[model samples]
Structures are given as structure tokens and as C-alpha cells.
Target: MATIRALVPTQLERRMKTPAFGRRALLAGFGIGALGALTGCRAEGFAPSAVPNGNIGSNLNIYTWGDYSDPANLEEFGRQGVQVQTDSFASNEELIAKLGATRGTSGYDIVVPTSTYLTLMSKNGLLEKLDLGKIPNLANLDPEFQDSIADPQNAYAVCKNWGTTGFLYDSTVINRPMNSWADFLEAAQNEASNNVSLLEDPAEIAVIYLAAKGYDPLSTDPKIVAECADYLTNQLAPHVRAFSSTPQNFIIQGSMTLVHAFNGDARRGYLEAENPERWKWVFPTPTANRWMDTWAIPVGVQHPDAAYAFINFMLQPDQALKDVDYIGYSTGLTGQRELAEAAGLKMLDVLFPPAEILDRLVSLEITEASGAWVDMYGAMQAKAGA
Candidate 1:
């Protein structure tokens, strides 16, 4: 295990900006001095026309994935009179479970959830339908994110960021070409055990095995699910160093040479690490899970008005650009799309990927019975620990 050290934000930023250090390596192709400048289109300034009062007060509470947003967004919101409070969760299941447990009293005004959870939350009446009219910035969004499956008709959520789940590795550390799940498993067992980590999410773990087995990533049949569970418990579990919800730390500290990660995160790590030569990311061939995450106001939010105001603020092209630069995920803001692409692979293309790669992307078709992933993940952790 790697001992954790605390670094101030400035220290971390300085590290990430250095060519030999962090994100600078990922920028080798573009050679851009500043990422925020990547948004090629004119950034129309933000004006609160939709809200008559904007009496939303100075406080806004947000629940989101850990380390997912730009602190600059918080500063911008503060300038606009909204004090932002952000809480994070490890998985979508955690987000839904929290909201489900609290119901009307979830206390969170805004939450960033992926497409599936947004749809589920909407259907369960746990999300507030947006008055799209209030958010003129919606026009700035790419058509693909508008009126999405997660919030059909653009009813509840606004597009946040999107990416794919894969893994990043230290090529020099492993000293081998890891192209597919088969290679990943073999390396974990032989060269990388106790030095590699897999995703803590069972849906992702299942996708890895299912892809190796040539089954659909989102198979609904219980039998296929069972096979996935069997592979996870009987094979992958013993070799995995740990099941990490935020596995990027494994790559950062060099405790784990190979790590299951989201493409954006791997890219982020590559840009932030000491050894750029050691870092590499791959979307397992044949297929990978493509994901879209969105920001939504939870139903019965205490600061609904402020939530609207804050979201509108984020949707602005300039603000969205800062987020993509900081977070390394692709956004659907129309003005920022070209800029994001210019930011290059590991940033945009790898997150959104090219059209040919898009056909290989699969979305998880989870159902109520998907609780099995949660239990299985827990069991695997316990077994690994033992």
C-alpha cells in the first residue's frame, strides 16, 4: 500500500502544469499554453433573464462525484452571490441510495448523476423538471446531450460531462503490452498482483469479463450475470491489489502500475504524474462502457432558485471550458465542443472518442435487481482483504 501525503492545491496545480510533471504530457499534441482558451466559439456572457427574482440566496449545496468539478466554478458562483457546498459519492448507486434514503429531505440542491440515474430519479419523482425556458444556455449544448435518454425532453438534468471506463497503466512498470482484458488479467496475476487495482464498481468489472467472453456488456440474462460474478470472485479477485472507487491514486503513488480507470481520469493522471513515459491508457478493444453524466436539481431542493441560477452560470461556454480543462472530461456545450476536440486525445477524443470507436461503446442496462453488483463488490473486497 502507498502512504498518502497531503499537498496543497497550489502545489498540485504546479505539478500538473509542468511538461515533465502532470497534464502537460497529455498536451504534447496541442502545445496549448492555456486550456481554457480551447473553447473556440464566442462565449456569450451570462445574464439571469429567466429568473425574475434570482432571490435564491447566497448558498447552494451540490452532491457530485469526488474531485469532479473545477474550483474555478465555485469562485465564479461565489462572485455571482452563491456560496457552493459540494459533497461527493463513490458510485451512482451511492447517489441514488442517498436520495432514496432521504426522500424529500435529501438536503442536496444540485446533484451530478449519470444518464440512467437521472431517468430513474425522474421516474421516481425525485428530480425537479427544469423549466428549460429559464436556461437559455441550453441552446449552447450539443444536440446529443439535449433531450437525452437520462432526462427525456430535457425535463430534469443538464448535461455535465461524459467519458468511458477503461484502465491506465505504467507501460515501463509492467514492461508488457496490455491490450485487452485478457492481458490485464494475466498481468494482474503475474507481474502486477498487489500492484494493480480494478474498479470498485461491479458493472465495470462485469463489462471487463463479458467483453472477454464476447457477451453484450449490458446483458440482462441472469445466467450471464452469474458467469460475470463467478469470474470476478474466482479469478480476478485474488489477483487485484485492491478494489478502488478512486483508483487514480494507485497510478499516482506508483503502488499500482496498472489501474482500472475512466479515460478522462487516466488522462488526468498522465498529465499530473512524475513519469509521463510510464503512463498509458487503453479502451479494451471489441468494446468498452460509454457513459454520460449530468447535473440535475434534486426534487424538493431547499434552494431551488439558487440551483437554477448556478446551473445557468455553469452552462456558459467560458465556465464549461474551465471545467473541461480542469476535470479532463468532455462536455456537450456546443461552443466548447470544438475547443474540447482541440484539447486533443486523453482529453476529448478519448472521452467522446471518434465515430468508429463510438460504435463499440455500450451503455449499462441496469435494472432494480442490479443490487447484485453492490453485494458482489463488497464480497470481493472482503475476500481480497482476507
Candidate 2:
């Protein structure tokens, strides 16, 4: 068992600073200048001609993950003579709630949310449709990214990066071939007893429950989701060690025998733990939901051109490569294949798992833009928490 210490950003600030490195990355990160005056890294200058033509808002307020954007990235925008500031959110739900409360008057220019949430926001008219013509770098995105379920038409948002969720288990504790989500739940039930932990968030739990019941978590039916809620509370709740919203540190200290974890976190854990084989990953059998983070221009963004410039610039092969390395996820950039190989990242199966295995994975998706489903999912989560 490992003690899991998760690095969750505070509810107030909801972000942490990544160490600024790489010459080009440093320059690109200059986009973070307006957020703070501190200079961490510098990148090539951000410049674009397609500044929004009509009724664009002046204040470039952005809401995103703390580490996703930095002082340097802000500084790059600042250099473009755009006024920008950022607010961080810990979860997609929090950002959704904020956007609703502000009612499209939040004065934010950009909002980066997970792929699933992009659908919800787009349906609600919270996101501004991207003018791809202005973002020529859209061409640089990998084919997998260009083809997304949430934004099928490439209209609402753009994929930034993607990763997966599963369990990081101690291979020696109860050695057997661990292959799927069901195996993890069974082991958590048998090995950890009441100490077994799962992700505390409703969205993930709902998805896991659906997987357990052989149903898609993104299913829109109210009755089916209710069935999922009942299934989780009845079957797995007793074995749960803890419903951890953040479980990183627990795994680190050997307090967690099995953890529902992200692939990147699992990789970091394997690297940090002295016993390399002690930590291993499990990709669900049929499929587990793939996670993606994306970028969107808010409705009132004044510096849409700079924002597009930044996105296109980020689409550059080198920029995407740096992001993949720094963020610990596979990006939708064409160059990562060679870059990851050259960087020896291919050796990390958790990062670059076997081709056949990845083919079996599925990204969670919304069946329809329905408030009823969201409410149903939310209710199921509340029950799981109880």
C-alpha cells in the first residue's frame, strides 16, 4: 500500500506553476506575462493579423488549469499589446458553474475545459465558435485529435492533449495478470478491504459504474444512470478504502495498494517509487474513457487574434512536443511520434502503451446535450459520496 498525496490546486487559486524550461518553450510561455511580471521561460514572439474585426471585448480574461498556462505564455500575449489575466479552476464542474453564474458576462476571452465539458458549454452557448481560418495551425493537430466526438465538426473547440484513467497497482502484493477495470475493483475489494479507494468525483464514478454494468457512462437515459448509481452503492461501496478526489500522495507512501489513477500520474508514480515494477497500470478490458483537455475562445474575447496566434503557435511541432513532455500526456501533434521516440518516452508503456491496447480504449462522450443527463449523473455522484 502506498500513501497517496495528490497535488490538487487550491479551491481559491486552483493552479500551480510548472518549472519554465526549454528555450522555445520559455519564449512561448512569455504569453503568461500579464498574469505576473516574473520571467520564467521565453518563446518565439506571438503575432497574428486576424485580430477580431467586430465588437470584440477588450479584457482578455481566461479560465483554465493552473499549470496549463503560465506567466510566460501570458507575457507573450502581453507583448502583443493585449490585456490578459487568468483565473484557475480545479474541476470542469467548477468552471461550468462559474460560467453559468456569470451568464456569458464573465468577461473571459478563453476557457479551457475537458472534452466532455466542451459539449455541455457549446450547447449552452457558452463557448465562442472558433474561426479556423484565423488559426492556420489547426492543420498541425494529429488526425486523432482533429476527429473528436464532442466537437465533431471542429466548430466549437480544439483538442489540446489526451490521457487515460485506470488503476496503479503494486504488482507484487497480490500478483496476478491485472488487465481491466473489473480486475482493479475486485482486487481493491479483496486486497485493501475498507482501505480501497476510488476517485471521489461523480463524473468518474458514474463512468466506472457504467463500465461495471456494461453500459456507457455517457448514456443519456435517466433510468439507466439510476441503475448505475444503485449498482455502485450496492456492489463497490463497502470495499472502498476512501473516495479520494486526489490520491497521488497515498500511492507514493505505499499506503494505497490499488488506486483509480490517471495514466500520467501512474507514470510519475512508477518513476518516483524506488521499486519500478512495484507500480503498474491497468487499462480496462472492453474500454475505459479517454480524457482530453481543450481550448476555446470565450464569447467576449477582445484578443481573439492573439488567442488564435497562440493556439496556432502552440500547434507548432516543437511547442506540442514540449507540452507533451511537460504535461505528461500524449498530444495531438504529428511530431510527437518521433519526438517521443527520440526522448525515450516510448520505453514508458504507461505513456506510450501497445498499439492494440490503445485501440480498445474509448473516450467518454455525451449522447446528447441534455440537462436531464447532467442532473442524473450529479445525483448518482451524490449517492456514491454518501
Q: Which candidate is the best by lDDT?
A: 1
- Taking the tens digit of each residue's C-alpha lDDT, what string does model 1 give over 1-386? 11111111233323233232211122221122212211122224535437775455667788776666788777666665566777766445456657776776888898888786675577676788888887787788888667765567888888888778777877876787778877777776677776767765567777788887888776767888787887777777877767665566666676777788888777766666777668777777778877788889887799877787778878888788888888777777775657765655344555556777767787675563355555566567666623
Model 2, residue 182: what's the lDDT?
73
How displaced is residue 73 in candidate 2, in Å? 4.9
> Which 10 residues in a row give candidate 2 its minimum summed lDDT?
19-28
The regions of model 2 sitting more than 4 angstroms off are: 1-60, 70-84, 220-227, 344-347, 366-386
- Per-residue accuracy of model 2 over 289-311 as CA lDDT, tens digit each: 67788888866565675567666
Per-candidate TM vs. native?
0.80, 0.77
Each prediction's whole-model lDDT (CA): 0.68, 0.62
Model 2 C-alpha RMSD vs. true structure (Å) is: 8.6
lDDT, candidate 1, at 14: 34
Error of 2 at 236 (Å): 1.4
| Model 1: how far residue 5 lies from native, Å | 39
Cα RMSD of all models vs. native, in order, equals 10.4, 8.6
